[model samples]
Target: MSGVARQIDRPRRWLVVLVVAVILFAGAVVAPSTGITRMGPFGLFAWASWLHVFGYAFLSLTLVYALLVSPDGPALSAAIVPIIVVAYGTSLELLQLLIPYRSFAVGDIFADGLGTVVVVGVWTYGQAAFAALGFRGS
Candidate 1:
């Protein structure tokens, strides 16, 4: 493909990734947790906590990638992506309150925020390092 075509397609690809990530997150959040802890190596709360971290981390990364690939994306994507992800996480947690089988947990929010911060921090620093080494990054 031509460079122009590739450039135009990048944002679309990332947006698709972002959408998939969101759908997966919602599915995992709303699904019944009956057998999850028993199946996972980590017991009970640990498994759920790790899920919160990894899920939000992936979601945040996809969001950042989508924004970064867009021509008119925000100048401070690293700053905004975490806020967006955390807010989304919080909203999901609040939604759990209405579900009879699901209850809200503040710890899950903390895990989500932790994941967003770690991923965004590493991404920002990795981009800087690549730039310092004279490499172009997206």
Candidate 2:
């Protein structure tokens, strides 16, 4: 592919990934809960909490990748991506309040924010570390 085509392609691919993440997030949050209250030896709540954490983490990572691959990507993406992801999570939680089978939970929002922060922090640190080691990428 030509340079221009490659550049456009990269952002498009990340955008597709971001869209898929959003769809999965929506489905998870909006779907009615299964009556099964236990998984293996663990309570369903425990698994759900971890799911919220990891799901938002994955969502935020995709957002960062999408922004970074864009032609006009921001220099402060590490700082911005978490805020965006957390906000999205919060909005989804609020949305759950209206669903008959789903209810909003502040704990879920906290978990989502925690996941976003942890992932972004590690990503930013890793980038800085790589730059310091003279292995920076364009």
Candidate 3:
């Protein structure tokens, strides 16, 4: 395959996952009651909205993992992912306000941002440690 095609293949799955994640999360926010998601232990007996952040946290970890696996991945993308996460979370909270059942809460944003921070910090630190040891592969 040509260089461009090969390059495209690498991030193609990322793009797909990114889109699906956004859509699914959007669906969760647009009609949270219709959308049912469970996080098992991560739920911690919290409301589904809160546990939804936990799901995003895991999604963030997947994105970070994909970024780490890519040779051309940059720290800038690692940093920006959290911003995307925060913005997405902010938007979701705003959307939730429209739902009669869901009220916008500062707590949700805090939870989402906290999750984003944890994912980015852990991912970045792991990348640094792996680079030091010359580890590779997803």
How accurate locally, in lDDT, is each candidate? 0.77, 0.75, 0.68
Q: What tens digits encode model 2's per-residue C-alpha lDDT throughout 1-138? A: 467986788778677766867775676566656742234235446666777788888887877777664445444568898888888888888878888888788988898888889988998888789989998465
State every prediction's TM-score relative to the real structure.
Answer: 0.79, 0.79, 0.68
RMSD value for candidate 2: 3.1
Give the runs in model 3 whose Cα sits over 4 Å from its true position: 1-5, 23-27, 30-50, 65-69, 73-77, 136-138
User: Which of the numbered candidates is closest to the native, going by highest lDDT?
Assistant: 1
Candidate 2 vs 3: which has more TM-score: 2
| Candidate order by decreasing TM-score | 2, 1, 3
lDDT of 3 at 39: 46
Each prediction's RMSD to truth: 3.1, 3.1, 3.9
lDDT of 3: 0.68
Model 1 residue 80 distance off true place after TM-score fit, in angstroms: 0.5
